[model samples]
Target: MNPLTAKRIAATGSAALKLLMPGLCFVVSSLAAAPVSEVAEQFDRHFEQQLVEHHIPGGVYAVIEGNQIVRVRGVGVRARGGDEPVDPYTVFRIASVSKTFAAGLAAVLAEQGYFSWNDPVVNYVPDFSFRSARYNKALQVEHLLAQTTGVIPNAYDNMIEANVLPDRILPHFRQLDPMCTPGECYGYQNVLFSLIEPIVQQTTQKDYATLMQELIFDPLQMATASVGMEPFMNSANKAMPHVRARGGWYQSTVVPSYYRFAPAAGVNASAMDLSHWVMAQLGHYPEVMPEHLLATITDKRVRTVRDLRRGHWRQFIRDAHYALGWRVYQFGDEELVYHGGWVRGFRADVAYSRDRQVGLVILLNAESNIVSELSTYFWSKVFDAIHIAEAEQFSELHSTEDD
Candidate 1:
């Protein structure tokens, strides 16, 4: 067979295998690989039950298939005891998922020859300095996106939680210590990403927020996505974040940081809006972005710690690596690209397998370590159901031949 024909055959087989395998349990009986709508409904019900059982205030999800959003679902109340309902347009703070967008922005400018990934940080931020002189020379834009910046645990964690003004934190970032030589270990550090914020400003001659709005958000048509905290709070369709206390769910009423850092964790979006975000990852719209740039950002560069599931998760999650702004995970000989976001009382998870041409996105208002575990469980079951249903249907058809 021709090489191109063999590649096509391999991709089709992988997707068919995904549908034929029974996913993690905890789904409705009607769900089968028979139809996409049935699998979507099963996922909706599975998440609804998870919300009430785990005391999650609310959540939303979208499933994308072959460049289109095939299903979007919301469950529970946005706030416990509140009348607000989670919906397609309801926006939530996506925490670190913002990194993916920032990295994408950097890739765009880099492709335009504005700067290369290996460009020294000090090259742009002329005054840039780190704790050690050797570290200063080693730091590069790739270090920021790859989580290789020798910085210790997030430099501005306190300032971010305290809602400190950005101007206060931006100038003093040179005080943090290096954890390892750059490009040696993948210790996640947000302050390292702070470096990219300045580079984007210097290169584009615009703040990272404006650059993102012009380059990514507007182009993707993610109308509801933004990096502003106050505007999100005042929005009519935004979800109220909740936290579980000793007795029940309580509203989290803390003020947000005044300034935005597009490089790290500062994005707010809806499930519907994020579905399109995943579509962009699959190289669906070449006009908005060059195919090569998207491919560069999603390429696997470094391995991760472990998989994020239970009961056979170890087998399914591997070939993990940190790409530009996303985590690439491989399962059962197929690859999936995804990112998870968490800030305070909000959580978001988005994943899509390039091989299968199918993806899922989940957002929740309340924090529970179990929330992600449960969401993964639910989706895995969906994957399994699709496969089992296909097998059963196939068997039934074959049975007629034997008769």
Candidate 2:
């Protein structure tokens, strides 16, 4: 009726719209957020199926997102026909995954001026030698961690596997010929890689195990992480390594010789402890995993000839390369930092995406091809979940604009 009354009614309507808009936006945002628990449950189901299909005796895995462990689970028994079930606390030998720790520790020590990655190995271990005088003179600390020492790949693995003492193996480096100049090629190493132990020992006046405990395990509160066969076997919650027999998995006797190459393959830990290790690697704990140090260790130092198309989720992997102690894979546009380990009957895989702040660690007591398959499946699921959440958020934003 009256002009003034009409204006007052219009103002009240505008105020109500403003008040309601925020609640509406809140609802839309909530709808866009992915249900993490649901995704985790789905992953658990898939993982369980995989364990059964692969006939794995025992396994444990941890999935990490940002600073949190989103999933921590285990399937199957600790030993074939044994009543003990695998769980987050059950420890397994991480094998060559231990090299990642060695690289990280070297980076930390380098930052503190203990040694440089490029420092000559001979400077630390003056007795170090190679059949080729050129390689003997040119070999640097970085070359060892990168597995680019120009020595034949796994040249001494047979000896190591045969239970030859590492100290005895050390002097035999003079007997093996260099395949190329140091840092020119990629070669997977075990005995030569353990040379980092002597370098670390000489620089810090402490053994590699003590250094890892002081720098990594202690700070991250990885209570179950340790190096050496004695501690691993003596631990109450350790998994018995297993191997596939004629028709099924069977437990294997512990081999103590690998402990001598502690820097390369001796670290043992549980999935629960490794979740924290992954979190630190993902930059959750800056004090423990300094950005510069991480950057140094994760630098793409060498190219690998690994074919991604051979795996189940081959479509996602574009290329693969090797960083110091870790492998880097191009997954679409994102980079996956990964490493896999095999020692006797045990197998391990660890991987993380820096951009997504997501990671996975899988440990199995029985040797099998399941680790690679499960890794691919796990990453596919994670990327799918992230994409779905993003799509929902985009829809919500556009709908709000139209309204």
Candidate 3:
């Protein structure tokens, strides 16, 4: 083996090798089994190579299989030209992945009779109004989570990026025209989507952050997960945001203002925390991610403009649609729940297969399109492994019957 590969194997220890080597043997066995450790190692090597090739400053990733965290690894330094190494506990802005948390909280509240999905926004926020009376009247609680409010995509994201307060951005909607009737078309919104926070606060009589902590974070035991910018900035183990320039990657000095629009784009978490979140999504923690609630949130509500065929993994994706705070893709005969986020110089992507109970979450402290490519590559590996495992199991079953 190459020196680097030998060193890595040694550093990971005999346990990882024991798990991985046997798993490789299963791949060649009559009953092929793709163990979690083997799949995780493949992703680890791929991610490491990508980080070097793309000059990424820092990245943290987690893989979950069969409702268990299989791997958590970090590559590169926390900041460009710095010595701090990132790890599983290295905090990062999850950006719009916060929307998933918002949707979950809302779904939980709905289960408790706090509000119906179809409840009009006006009922929760009396002051809420759209420029078009038709849309204003038709808007429902679900529209915000579904990204079907008919507002222009990323409307006022620039303002949020400019460090404007979310309270000031809400009034701008009154001057904007709706592209379509509510729930009729997909029009992604950041500022408008965050309205869920106020609605939750009004109904639950608790702050949005507190509601998230009590309902989701605490139950999942996501110790490093936190809302808003303060906690993230104050974290000693957090990755510093970086931007690429002509010379090399440089640290960003801009304050993360997206936390002001907490429900839409503000969330900070480590790979370890997100691994538990992924497990919950896969129905491991039903007490928190109840079956009915998961069904409601993941239901395909509207078609998005995403064209899966343009990517290299086009042959794997059959169709794509928008669910509550997630993008649902038809992969073979199963559903792939996915979401990607970007804020300042940070980026994140998360996806899972409910049927297979396999998922991945990746957090990066650098700005690049590589995050999307990485997700596609990771999903391809997962699906390929599942296909092999299933085919081998079928062959084994038939042979046993014949014997």
**Reference-based lDDT, residue 391, model 2:** 37
Error at 270, model 1, angstroms: 0.7
* Each model's lDDT: 0.71, 0.80, 0.80
Candidate 3: lDDT over CA atoms?
0.80
Q: Write the per-residue lDDT of candidate 1 for residues 1-403, one digit (tens) a residue.
A: 3343356446554323332234331111222333445667787777777777887888888888768888898887777788878899999888788888878889988988788999888888777676566677788888889877756656777776677766677566567657778777676766567678888778878877788888888988899988767658777898877777887778897356523554677788999888888888777867666789878888776666644343334435535678888887655445667777777788888887665567788898877665556545545554442222344555564455334
Model 2, 190-259: lDDT tens digits are: 9888889998898889978899999999999899999989889889988998888888888899998788
Q: Choose 1 or 3, whichever is better by TM-score.
A: 3
TM-score of candidate 2 versus the correct structure, residues matched by position: 0.85
Q: Which ten residues in a row have the lowest lDDT in candidate 1?
A: 24-33
Return the clash pairs for model 1, or none.
19-387, 20-387, 21-387, 22-384, 23-381, 23-384, 23-385, 24-380, 24-381
Measured against the true structure, the TM-scores of the candidates, in listed sequence, are 0.82, 0.85, 0.85
Mark the regions of model 1 whose C-alpha exceeds 4 Å error after superposition. 1-36, 153-156, 164-177, 306-315, 378-403
Over 4 Å off, model 2:
1-38, 307-310, 313-315, 385-403
